[model samples]
Target: MRAMVIEENGGPEVLRPSEVPDPVPGPGEVVVDVTARGVNFIDIYQRSGLYEVPLPFVPGMEAAGVVTAVGEGVEDLSAGQRVGWAMAPGAYAERAAVKASLVVPVPDGVSDEQAAALLLQGMTAHSLTHSVHPVSEGETVLVHAAAGGTGLLLTQLAKARGARVIGTVSTEAKERIAREAGADEVVRYTETPVAEAVRELTGGEGVAAVYDGVGRDTFDAGLASLRPRGVLVLFGQSSGPVAPVDPQRLNAAGSVYLTRPSLAHFVADRQELLGRAGDLFSLLAQGRLDVRIGGRYPLADAGRAHTDLASRRTSGKLLLV
Candidate 1:
C-alpha cells in the first residue's frame, strides 16, 4: 500500500510519500481501503513536531472508506461495509488497519467524501455543544475560527441547540462562510479588534461561553468576550500556544470557567465513540448539519493539505484521497 510516512516530524516536506506493506487486520481490527482522509490542525501539529508522535508515524487521524476485510470477533460488520472513524490513525494511505471497536458505519445518505469530512469535525461539534457548554435558547456563545472546519460545524450545532452564535473570522470570505453556517454575528478579527466587536454585539454584556480554537492570537480576547461565570473552552492553538497566565485572570474576568478539551477524552470508550459518531452522521443524513468538504487532494498530495491547513488558508473540511 502507498502511504505518506514521516521519518521525523518537521514541516510538510517531512511527510514523504512511500510504498509500505499492506495493512493486515488483527483480532478485533478491520482493514479499510481508505478513500478519503480528513485534514485537521492536529495533523499539522503532529507533522510540525509540536504534538510529538514517535518517529516514523502516519500523519492522519480520521478517514472513511470500505471495509476490505474484518478480523476475528467482529460481528455485524462485514467486508465491503462503508465506515468512518474519529480517532483512528494512519489514515493518510491506501489502507488502514483500525480496531473494529472504533469504526462506525457511515450513514446511507452521506457520501464517502462527506463522511471523511464530517467524522472528526462534526463529532467535535457534537461533543462540545452537547457536552462542554450545551447551548440553549436565550444563551449566547462565541466561536473562534468560525470559518474553519470545526468552527463551521460548531456554529451550526450551537445554533441547532438554540444559542445565538457570534463568530470570529480573518476575512470577508470567512465572514460569509460563518454566517452561512448560522452565526448570528460575524466579526472580522483581522480588521476590528475581535474582543471589542464581540462586546459591542452583545451590548457590552458578553457571551455565556467562548469556544476558542485560535489559541495564542485569540486567547486573551476570547476571555474578555465572556460574561460573568462564562466558560472559555480553548481546544486548539492555531495561531500559537497561549502564554502562561494568572489564574486570577479567569476570576477577575467574570468568574469564567476555562477548559482545554481534546477529542480523545470525549471519545474515551467505545460506547462514547459510537454515540458521537452516530449522532453526527445521523444529523448529516437528515440534512440538519452540513459538513462542507472545502478541499480535496490526492493521497500523495498530503503535504499540500498540511501546508494549507497550517497557513490558515483553507476553510471548512479538507480531505486527502
Candidate 2:
C-alpha cells in the first residue's frame, strides 16, 4: 500500500510518500480500503513534532472507505460495508486497520468524501456545542475561525440550537463564509480586536460561550469575549500552543471557565461514537448541514495539503482522495 510516512518530524516536507505494507485486520479490527482522508491541524501538530508520536507513522486521523476485510470477533460489521472513523491513526494510507468499535457506518446518503470530511471535525463541533458548553436558545456564543471546517460546523450547530453566533475570521471571504454558515455577526480579527467587536455585538454583555480552536493567538480574545461565568472551549492550537496561565487570570476574566477538549475523550465509548456520527449523517442526509470541501489532493500530495492548511488560506475541509 502507498502511504505518507513521517520518517522524522519537522515540517510538511517530512511527510514522504512511500510504498508501505498493506494493513491487515487483527482481532477486533477491520481493514478499510480508504477512499478519502481528512487533513487536520492535529496532523500538522504531529508532523511538526508539537505532538509526539512514534516515528515513521502515517499522519492522518480520520478517513472514510469500504471495509475490505473484517477481523475475528467483529460480527456487526462485515466486508464490503461502508464505514468511517476518527481519532485513529494510519488513515493517510490506502488502507487502514481500524478497530471495529471505533468505526461508524457511513449512511447511503453521504458520500465517502463527505464522510471523511465531516467525521473528525463534525464530531468535534458536536461535542463542543452539545457537551462542552451546551449552547442554549437565545444564548450568544463566539466561534473563532468560523470559516474553517470545525468552525463552520460549530456555527451551524449553535444556530440550530438557537444561539446567536459571533464568528471571527481574517478576511472578507471568510466573513462571508461564516455568515453563510448562520453566524449572526462576523468579526474580522485582523481589522479589529475580536473581544472588543464581540462585546459591541452583544451590547457589552459578551457571550454565553466561546468555541476557540485557534490557540495562543486567539486564547485571550476568547476569554475576554465570554460573559460572566461563560465557558471557553479551547479545542485546538492551530496558531500555536497557549502559554500556561495563572489561575487568577480566570477569576479576573469574569470567572470564565476554560476547558481543553479532545475528540478521543468525547467518543471513548462505542455507543457515543456511533451516536455522534449518526447525528451528523442524519443532518447531512436531510440537507440541514453543509460540509464544504475546500481542497482535494491526490494521496501523494499530503505534504501540500498540510502546507495549505497551515497557511490558513483555505476554508472548509481539505481531503486526500
Candidate 3:
C-alpha cells in the first residue's frame, strides 16, 4: 500500500508519499480499501504539529471506502460493504483499519467521493445548525468564511431551518459562492468592516448568533456582530488560535455566550455518529444538499492538496483520490 507518511511534524512538505505495508484489521476492526479521503484542517494541524500525534503516522481523519476485510466479532459490517468514517486517524492511505463501531454504511446513491467529503464537514455543519445553537426560522445568523467547505454547508443548513444567514468572505468569488449557498447577505470582509457591514445590514440590530470558524483574526468581529445575548460558536482557528479570553468581556459584549465545539464531542457514540451521517447522506441522496468537490488529487499529490487548502485557495471539499 502507498501512504502519505508523516515522519515528522512540519509543513505540507512533510507529507511524503511512500510504499508502505497494508493495514491489517484487529479484532472489532475493519480494513477499508480507501476510494476517497477527505482533507481537513485537522490534517494540517497534525502535519504542522499544532495538533500532536505520534511520529510516523498517516494524516487523514475521514475517509470512504469498501470494507476489504472484517475483524473478529464484527458482525454488523462485512467485507465489500460500502462504509465511511467521520472520525478516524490513519486514513491518508490506500487502506485504513478502523473500528467497526465508528464506521457508517454509505447508501447507494452517494458516491465514495461524496461520502468522504460529507462525513467530517457535513456532520460538523449539522451539529452546528441542529445542536450547538439550533438556529430558529426567521432568526438572523452570521457565518464566517462562508465560502469554505464547512461554511458553505452551514449556510445551506441554516437556511433550510429558515434562519436568515449573513456570510462574510474575503473575496468577490467567495461572496458569490456564499450567496449561492442560500446566504441572505454576503459581506466582503476584506473590503468592508465585517461587524459594521453586519450591523448596517440588520439596521442596527445584530444577528442572533455567529458561526465563527476563522478564529483569532475574526474572534473580536464575531463577538461584536452578535445581538444582546447572542451566541458565538468558535469551531476552528484557521488563521491561528485565539488568545485566552476574559469572561468579563462576554458580559461587556451584552452577556453574550461563547463555546468551542468539536465533532468528536457531538458524535460521541455509534448511534449519534450514524444518525448525523445518515441525515447528511439522505440530504445528498434527495438532492437537497450539494457537496462541491473543489479539487481532486492522486494520493501522491497529497502534499499539494495540503498547500492549496492551507493557502485558502480552494473552496468546498478537497479529496484524495
Tell me the lDDT of candidate 2.
0.93
**lDDT over C-alpha atoms for residue 280 of model 2:** 96
| Per-residue lDDT over 87-206 for candidate 1, one digit per residue giving the tens place of the 0 to 100 score | 778998999999898898987888889989988888888888988888888799999999999999999999988899999988999999999999999988878998899889989999
The clash count of every prediction, one per candidate, is 0, 0, 0
How much does candidate 3 score in TM-score?
Answer: 0.99
Instruction: Rank the candidate models, highest lDDT first.
Output: 2, 3, 1
Q: Rate the local accuracy (lDDT) of all candidates.
A: 0.89, 0.93, 0.93
Q: How does candidate 1 fare on TM-score?
A: 0.98
* TM-scores of all predicted structures: 0.98, 0.99, 0.99
RMSD score of candidate 3 (Å): 0.8
**Runs off by more than 4 Å, candidate 2:** none
lDDT tens per residue, model 2, 1-321: 889999998978888889988888999999999999999999999888889999978889999999999999999899999999999999999899999999999989999999999999999999999999998999999999999999999999999999999999999999999999999999999999999988888899999998989999999999988889999899999999899989898999899898999889999998999999999999999999999999999999999999999999899999999
Q: Is candidate 1 or candidate 2 better by lDDT?
A: 2
Candidate 2: RMSD to truth: 0.7
Pick the lDDT winner.
Answer: 2
Task: Write down the worst ten-residue block by lDDT for model 2.
Answer: 8-17
The residue pairs in collision within model 1 are none
The clash number for model 2 is 0
